[model samples]
Target chain A: MSERAAAGIRIERVVKIFGDVGITALNEVSLDIAPGEFVSILGPSGCGKSTLLRCVAGLDTPSKGQIVVGGVPVSAPPEHLGIVFQRDALLEWRSVIDNLLLPIEFRGGDSRAVRPHAKALLRMVGLEGFEDRYPSQLSGGMRQRVAICRALVDDPMLLLMDEPFGALDALTRDQLNIELQRLWLANRKTVLFVTHSITEAIFLADRVVVFSPRPGSIADVIHVDLPRPRKLAVRTSELFHGYAGRIRTLFEGMGLLKEDE
Target chain B: MNRQSLQGVAITTMTLIVFGLIWEAGVSYFGVKPIVLPPPSAILRELFSELPWYLGHAWFTLIVTLGGFALAVVIGVALAVLIVESKLLEKTIYTVIVGLNSVPKVAIAPLFVIWMGTGAEPKLAIAFLIAVFAIVIDTVLGLKSVPADILDLGRALRGSRSMMLWRIRFPCALPSLFAGMKVAISLALVGAIVGEFVSSQRGLGYVILSAQGTFDTARVFAAVFLLAILGMLLFAAIVRIERWALPWHASQKDYSPSA
Candidate 1:
């Protein structure tokens, strides 16, 4: 591990307008994420939570605002950061171990030196025996695990994930949630996870930043005081339901979730 | 080979033998004139007697086809990359290639003979011109087919444009490139024969043409048989290369998606 301090993020009034017709995806969205915080941006589909994540990753630039990461403004994908998409994005030609080593290779590090770290990460994800397996050989859940290992192989300070479990089955999603929490507890890297799952956001995040529907802006921020090393059973607790109920009510206000007559 | 592939080979060989027997019986039963359509037995006899002579002409055709195919791969891949990388090249170069492909390559075979003379050069040139189009089109398709999320992942990782192309796009394009090559190799053989037809002193095409002029129907059948074998071998060679280079794709083919 790098032993470097985790990075904080500051999204200062970021406004993103797409194309000539001026579709405003993010409308003056701003948030402050402390170092080592696990923050999830939760909202409905077409909500600019993903847009916010993209701005922080430097994959897209905000038209009217700036994003500061690790004490410096993000220009072109700031150093010591990693991202995972909904799809595993593992190079089909590469084996699982090689896929894990991709970020190191991209950063001009010697892959030979990082091989041990990559192996350790795979072991951490319960994929030790699958080091030589191709992505196509693995199930959907296993591929996503490889992708998460790939992102963490470089020991990034800030990790951004965009709906990383959206495609997974419910059982796999629950399992990955537990694994992700364990991993997060171990490294505690600053994570800005984007998702539409209310329970998932509250279960995984230190704070859930809810966004309104399209032309997305922060609707509310709910802090989860649930203890560390949270198990799946914790999701059924009264306190967990309190946080979920608050988020549900917020979504109901935004016309995202409705109570049937 | 595995048991499955061995069984496949056995079945293919059995089918070919049945086809040969049918042709032999039909020719003899119909009492076809030797000058019109010789029996498969007669063609086979000619092939065995002139084995060394037929081998030399077949070798010439093979060399010209392979040479042209190699040239097409190099230039075609380079051009496809340029077309993908630059909007200007896509607009100008790709448009020109598509336009040039529409003109019949056989119609222009004689032009290559006129320009490069009655040597291997014209045959190779014709083969290249005929084969290049498939390479460019399939490669372009493959390069563009990379998933959007994968590109976004590359961008998030700060991959340089050249690095992304080399590490991601090019490898992703391999299966499609192999598909193009398989088609091109067969087309290259056809182009080589056309070039030889235009003007050549050697190759299977020359042997066929001279035999046709002399009314040596058996010799023509033998040369055509050799050409068919050559084309099949070249195509099989490409399929083998595809399997070797794309182990992931081959293994994935056997994978049941329900898993």
Candidate 2:
């Protein structure tokens, strides 16, 4: 972990319940992420990993618990944090460049100043020639790239991704994972990613936090001592397998891992 | 213009001419009196001969149609926004609007004339009543139909309520609003003509009523033709505006059948 002073995210006893039913989505979940660290909250479907991310992003308030980001309590989404959703969620009417500039527009930033930065971010995300194209004209992977650029346009201190590449094909997802790692390295923004892929979590995260299903709670938090600038080749490495195996064991212990696979 | 569009225009003009010729031939062959069923050519001649007199009537009808259409758009959009913003109001007011919309607007035109007045006001009111409910229902559905993930994205971006409305909700609702506008435009035309038929000194509706009373079939045909043209023009205008405003919409793109 980087020796950054501030805590990126601090969650304490977070509990979320839908309606009057005491059936919990999240039960006494707590986690702490260091500044500039890339952490993945890994779990199967209905594990409330997404709910945890939403609570941290302040999109949904926890029924009971506290979440602090960058030394400030996150009751509502703050200007300094950026979020990338599973679907691109890009405005179909807007051009790729305009979509990238959306966060800046929301924050009341100088449009003229942000335009250049937005352009640069789009280029960085490998969408250089697609600036003027509308979202409908772009392929699914390209649209997601535009969304990533939009999230990073404001140069936010923290980035929250809820399965940002979950909908993409395996090839596209792998490519984006590499792109994302490069982005995280260059920006050094604190990132909390939610995903179901064990290999993905092992490949991308400094720490992989696993959760149990239903009334989801942290099953385990395993540190990945894998070296930086991870490439696709790293996936076949023994180190990658070791980390993936540990995560699988954790899921197996929670009765989440399928016996067949 | 493309070859297909040019060909389409040629075919449309040819079809109209053929229809007109057939009608003229049928009337003349049957030796139909001008008082009963005059030829299409006779109606055309009468239309051109009394152009200035009909222009005034056309203007009056246009005013009522346009005025009512404007009112419907404003009230419909505003009410849709209100309904979408509040569930209790939506449930209560939506039922009332639906009930009112179901009642034949023509039956209420005379009542409107009594309440408002015969001069343009009642006509406009009738048109407004006819068109507004469609706008409200379609626009409300459009506003509400925005994807939940998009809304969540807005929330995540910390967008203000006003920002969300102006930037996201309004634009998202535009296609649906245009759909409502198209339906309302047709209804507005019918409403204006009906209002004039119920009580009016001028307009195509008045002309048709007078022609029927005097047994002048050619004049009645002319008036009906003009009204059809007016309805087509108004509907076409709305479609053109929709194309101009929402060029990014998927439906606007000319996709190959194979693609």
Candidate 3:
């Protein structure tokens, strides 16, 4: 309810050194995400994209620089952040509805008041009838959908997702990619999506941020400049192919990827 | 699965009968002394003849075992939680518990009898001592088994420490807790019997000890049979409760007769 704090995220010159091991994960990585903008971070495995997102989520502290979420600097986990991992991370003991209702439960409010919202969110994710089912009974894609509903339960200003659909098979991953796009379009929540898949980044994001390997620094930022409500068919389009090619070429230049795949 | 369970019971019954027949024939053929090795029929005859007397002692044993087991669970879980929450407890209390677990529980039974008297109190004290370590160790293992991603999920939700402990760790620890409980329950029974053996006016262990003293070998066998039934019944109860409490665990899958 704080209007002035609604500005999305300002991550200024963040660096992360994993102490003890003496490995530098991120170095002076600065990026600003506008309110309601969808940005994809495409990086190789050790490029610190996950580390950067963790810093923004306040799960990890940057060795230097500042991360501001909704006009508040994050030293501890902020109340207005949603994070989804590659693993769905649903509690096996909880039913789907209860899992989705976790944020409300965590905040210690009357969670019953959020029941209707939970139902509506489940329906929006096409998981309406499965509310009573345990996570073990669900397919991987379905579990990830429930996880996304969980992340959105609090209607956070920013959703920091680290390969949310990375574990699914190719067909299921593509399906979730479209499902996620539709959800994001409706909610218009600012999102920082991380993935290694170039096509996924090109197809889903308004901008794609690339990174170099260990002691990861931002290598390039490419704006997709594509239209919204993107369909799977868009991957066949010239502009989508152009974006993917450019991203691949950038990876090649960093020597992280082979010249031809 | 239902058929498999039936088959398992049927096979067990057949095996017991076959083994009994072989034993009885061997003892009769050899003209063995009844005191040295009684026939299965003689043992069964003894068990049924003293059914009422055995039941009284069995009931006492059951009560003490359950009482001690319940205390072990409560104290063990609280200790495990403290160990998880505080580094001081983890370093000092956990290490101490690990060290205490190595001591022979039978040796401790006499000390409990001396301090608490030759009553259910001594038996329960001994039983709790026997069972607490497994429950604490297993529950702590379960509580800590959550994936890094799951812990991150808790952090991202801005979950308070209490919330994380209750909603996340406790439920996650249930399967391991039950496994520990299975081990603990059996050990608790052993402790109660050991305490009864040391010095007790009542219970099956007392009956067995007195029967052996008087050379009533058949009665001893009968008491031993009752103890076996008691152990199986308690174990089966835990298994049933585990299925009810944790329908999501793979072990609870209806496909196994062990279910």
By TM-score, the best candidate is 1
Q: For model 2, which pairs clash? A: none
Residue B23, model 1: Cα distance from true site in angstroms: 1.8
After superposition on all C-alphas, the RMSD of every candidate to the true structure, in Å, is 1.4, 2.8, 2.7
For model 2, how does the per-residue alpha-carbon lDDT over A1-261 read when each residue is reduced to its tens digit? 222332378999999998777779999999999988899999999999999998988888999989988889988886567789999899987888888888888889887887877887777778887888777887788888888888777888888899999999999899899999988887888899999999888889999998899889998999998888988998898988888888888888887767874
True contacts kept of each: 0.58, 0.57, 0.60
Residue B221's lDDT in candidate 3: 90
lDDT of each: 0.92, 0.87, 0.88
DockQ, all models: 0.62, 0.51, 0.50
After superposing candidate 1, which stretches have Cα over 4 Å from the reference?
B250-259
- Clashing pairs in model 3? none
Candidate 3 lDDT, B105-167, residue by residue in tens: 887778887798876899999888898899999999999998889899889888889999999
Comparing 1 and 2 by TM-score, which wins? 1
Tens-digit lDDT string for candidate 1 (B128-243)? 99999999999999999999988988888889999899999999999999999999999999999998988989999999999999999999999999999999899999989888
Sorted on DockQ, best first, the list reads 1, 2, 3
> After TM-score superposition, what is the CA distance of residue B180 in candidate 2 from its true location, in Å?
0.3
lDDT of 3 by residue, A1-261 (tens): 112133488989888999999899998988989998899998988789999989988889999899998888999888867789999999989989899888888888678987888888888878878888888778888889899988887777888899998888999889889888987877888899999998898888989998888889988999988787788999999988888888788877877677555
Q: Which candidate wins on DockQ?
A: 1
